[model samples]
Target chain A: MQLRQLSLRPFRNFARIDLEFAEGGAVIVGANGRGKSNILEAICYQSIGKSIRGARDHEAVPHGEGHFDIRGDWQQGQRRHPCRVFYGADDGKRVFLDEAPLPRVSDLVSHFQTVYFAPQDVALVLQFSAQRRRLLDIVLSQADAVYLKALQTYQRLLTQRNHFLRSLGHRGVDPTEREVWDAQLAKPGALLRHHRLLGLVEIMPDFARQYDVFSTGQETAGLLYADEVIESNPDEIPTRDQLEATFRQQLRDGFEKERHAGHTLNGPHRDGFVFTIDGEAADAFGSQGQQKSVLLSWKMAELRLLERRKGQQPLLLLDDVFSELDPIRSAHLIEMVEDFDQVILTAPRQPQESLGDRYARIDLE
Target chain B: MGPEPLEDLVVAFTRLPGIGRKTAQRLALYVLKSPPQEAESLAAAVRAARENIGHCTRCFHLTERGQELCHICRDPRRDTGMICVVEEASDALALERSELMRGTYHVLGGALSPLDGVGPEDLRIAELVERVREEGIREVILAHNASAEGEATAEYIHQRLDGMTQVSRLARGLPAGSDLDLADRTTLAHALQGRVQF
Candidate 1:
């Protein structure tokens, strides 16, 4: 699948812009804060119904505009499917696939697959555990609906459990109801962690391989899932039942701590991955180059994992990431990126390694 | 925004499921623009339905004229041994409209949603249990929805009727006329998992 064209209206810095792509993909070139990344955001947002930069729909709208519109025409050989997304400040978001309303965000994910890469994605590995979990989830959710449903179920139950906890502190409530919520939460929560573990297992080699390709260091690369529920070997994926039992015990044990905090604490939401370089935590010990390599390799693994799982090459969106890469890594990235079916690169100046006819350059003014 | 009666009508429309403020406003305006007889008849229909339509004592289906039992329950040809339980009256109505299921119906009123403080006692679950135990039900098809709450409610009901009668859930898979390639991942997974031997 290929994104044939992208049109953005009243979205962020772009007042109204439309660009028709040359076959493979296009390089959106412009200076900082010039709406180059916004174009990439629009494309990724339409496919995923989310902001890669964590901006809300209201914030994505232009200063004077109350809403934003993004439409991308996709072509798979002879078939042309137009995907459109609309976001209103007051009305929420809506997506249309070939002019039919898609009611669910998860349903929209695989319609146009994208892997968004930027400098701060290191934070995905080095900082917040949620971002690391999201790294695994975003890929898995797009490929398998079962995983997505399980994730949604787990999130809803977590919200309910947390709400119960918050209420438990202020007023007297039924302890029996907590059992029901916990029972429901355990099943899906275990499934989520199990999938994340399986996701790591499946992509660990690809992650290491990509790291070797991108990194200058000679130390061994590793991605370990630091689960709070169960002690899982970094190499082995635990079964759902095993994780479920542990999750239930942890939730039960957390009752006292959770009561005082007024929020449920131990679950997949608190889980994170620790990226390692030669048995050392990358975030704490690795150099700047190693950290950037960790993020790049992880994202690259994501692309490969999605392709292997879904049997379709996902579109790669490079959002001002080339600026952060060294000359060798940038060259390596451009080479590997060319192999993807589609890649939309956002950069201040055109990279030295150019795709002659395979790329179209758009300058955001 | 409108006069007292018009605003009241719109607000009334808004109280119904899926009817938003804008739709309610449009409906109210449509009623206002129509002939006086049309508005009067609409009001009469709502008032009459609310006053007359009540849950049947036997099947829990909505019955008009304050009937003791719904028409399906009163029908002698319908099977008495099989009871298909649903979460809402509308679900039973849908099954009846489909012209499937010769069995009687029992509306649980709503599923067991613990988050909302609803449990077995909140629904007509105990009544359902009693009916199955005393009525000598051979099989109880649990036709509850596939949501989390629905699953829990079905499980709860299943445990109650486990030894008393054979309880089964509704079949889930792809809808008819959907191609395998075009079907969503979830539906396709369900269809494949529940596939019959060819």
Candidate 2:
């Protein structure tokens, strides 16, 4: 999907701004604090239906303003879609596609595919498991609708089960109730883990190869799905029935532990993906530059995965990460920019290298 | 603020489901502009309903204050041997609108939602069990909403009544008139899973 035009109102530092994108996407350049990142944020929000920086909806509203509105004209193949997202303090958030309101915010997923890369995303390799889990969720949610629905169901059931456990006072509750909850949870939990492991499996080779290209070949890269419910080898994507059976068994076996902890102790919620370099945990052994390389390679693999699954080039948003990259990684990003259908990147100063004839430059004051 | 009575009316309207502040204000204004007797009648209806309506002795459905049974329970033509269980009286009413079911209903008042502090004790599950055993019901149809909590409630009831009598859940699939394209992906998947022989 390509973002043809974008308009923002009362969004963060930009009270109002409108820009028409070029065929190859535009490079937004401005000094620090000039709202260069806000442009990319607006475009990302229009695609993903929320603040990409993890800010709450109201936080994006300008000072003393009650709401923020983002409008984008997107193109895919021969079809053009006009999308609008409006959030108000009183009415909450609403999204529209072709002038018809979507029933849920999640309905916006996969409609306009985008892959966003920011400096903070390096945390995917060097930070807590939640970041990597979120990366999996974002990529899968954008590539497959069923994955998004299953993910939403799994998260909600996890919360409800946790609350139910807390309400039980940690013991002596009837086992049938737990059985009911386990049966309810295992169905969606299995779907979540099945897709997660499948995604990791599909992206592993690409991830490994891209990491080698981005870094010295002396080290080998590996991705492993760390699951709590079912034990599987790195290459084995278990069937849904096997996953469900194992999930139910784990929940039954972990009842006492979960009851003691006052929450659920097993399921996809507690699962994660482990990135390793040279057969060692990258988060613990890799240097800062190595971690950046890991994240960059993972992102490139994610782009490929999305393209293969979506059958089209997804909009790539690079948020001012060029200065942080070495020449090698920067060269890789520029090559990716050329390969992609649209790329909107924000930088403090324009890179010296050319981005071909179709790329446009926008300077913000 | 406007007049205290008008504000009070708006607040009361706002307490109703799906009524926001703007909708409540509009409803209050409409009530104020209507004839005084119309307002009096609405108030009287609400008061009378609250005062007179009570749970049926056996099924927990709304009935007259002093009545021992609801109209369906009192009807001799209805099949007392079969009972349909539901989460709320409104659901029972929706089922009754079809004019297809000939059995009586047992309203559980609500489903089991431990997150909301609702449990088996909070609902009329024990009473349902008691009626099934004492009344010699042949089949119990679990007609609760198709939600996680509702399914859990059904599971709980099914376990409680295990081996006591035959039990079945309502068939879940696409609506009759809805096109296959109109159904959501989850619903479509469910319909596929629950598909039967042609």
Candidate 3:
């Protein structure tokens, strides 16, 4: 996909602005708190149908402003299209794709594919399990819609199951109904676990290969998924039926514990992955430098995997993450990004040394 | 996007179900270009209908004037022993348009959805139970949408009225004009489960 222009009205601190980027992508340069990231955020919001910063519409709209509107002209292959997003206090949020109203915001999510390497993503290695799950979810959701749909269904089923369990203490509900819900949840939950494992399997090799080369072959890296649900073997990728059976068994086994806990005690929601460096858990002792190399390798692998799966290169948004990188890694990052269709990088200071004319400068004032 | 009056009309139209801003604008402009008398008649009709119409005492469908019951509830020809429960008045109207169902109706305000914070109390389940007990309705057909919440609502209603009345849900299968190949797996599965002998 190609983003030709971004128009923002009363969004965040930028009262109004329209930005057009070169095909090679642009560099947004400004001091801190000058709404530089806001430009990239507006683009990302249009792309993903939500704030990448996880902000609510009311919180994102400018103070005292009744509304905010963002519009974009984009091209996917040879097709040129326009999208508009409008949010107001009275009317609420609305989205249009190619002048046609989108039934749901989710309709636009599949249309706009972007790989965001925000500064915070670098800390994913050291962050909580929720953060790591989010990273995996974003990649997988963009790669395939089925995965996203299954993930959403699993989440809803989890909530409904929890609600049913909570009602058990008060109501004389049939145990059959609880079993039915458990059976329903197991399929999607198992599918999610399966897909996430597949996603990691696809990205791990590239991560390992990249890390070894990028770190000058000093340490070995592996991305291992820990199956908290049923404690299934990490190496085996179970078929949907197998996963469903396993999930059901776990649900049955944990029924007593879950009844006491007032929530589900086992499922993909509790499952998380860990990074390994030289046969040791990265979460506990990996140095910052090791974390950065792993993060870099993982992101690069994600970019390649997305391109391979989607059959189109996704736009890369680096939000000031390129700062403070050593010369070799910076050069490597620049080289890797040049392969993307478009790359938008935001930084407090302009990139120096060998950035060349490939990146257009958008000096935010 | 338009002049203040036009925008206001558009916004008002958009408040209606399934009407987006663009469609609302088109409808507003159509009204504007239409004959002045026609527009007045439209507004007057809407106002008069809203003023006179209230919910039916039993079914909660639309009623006119100071009538105590809707036409359907007042009619002696319709079967009062069985009530077709639907999610909305529009659904009840659709059933009436089909001319297939001879029974009266019950309209739940909406389906049960915990995610949306709609519970059993938020719906017309209590009214439905009262009607079933007082009217001695024999069967309750759950003619609701085939969504998760809709199914849950039907199940809850079933549980509430268990042994008091017979409960049946609307049949699920391929649509009237769709091909068998076009039917989804769930639909086919349902059709097979509910299949009848030739």
Highest lDDT scorer: 2
Ranking by DockQ: 2, 1, 3
Worst 10-residue stretch by lDDT in candidate 2 chain B?
A: B112-121
Two-chain DockQ for each candidate model: 0.25, 0.72, 0.16
**Candidate achieving the largest TM-score:** 2
Best by DockQ: 2
Model 2, docking class: medium
Candidate 3: list runs displaced more than 4 Å: A228-236, B1-92, B101-142, B153-198
- Candidate 1 or 2, higher TM-score? 2
Error of 2 at A277 (Å): 1.0
Candidate 1 DockQ score? 0.25
Given the true complex, what DockQ would model 3 score?
A: 0.16
Across A274-329, the per-residue lDDT of candidate 1 in tens digits comes to 88888777888888888888888888989888888878888888877767888889
Residues A233-293, model 3: lDDT tens digits = 4466778788889989999999878977879988888876777787676767677767777
Evaluation by lDDT, superior candidate among 1 and 3 = 1
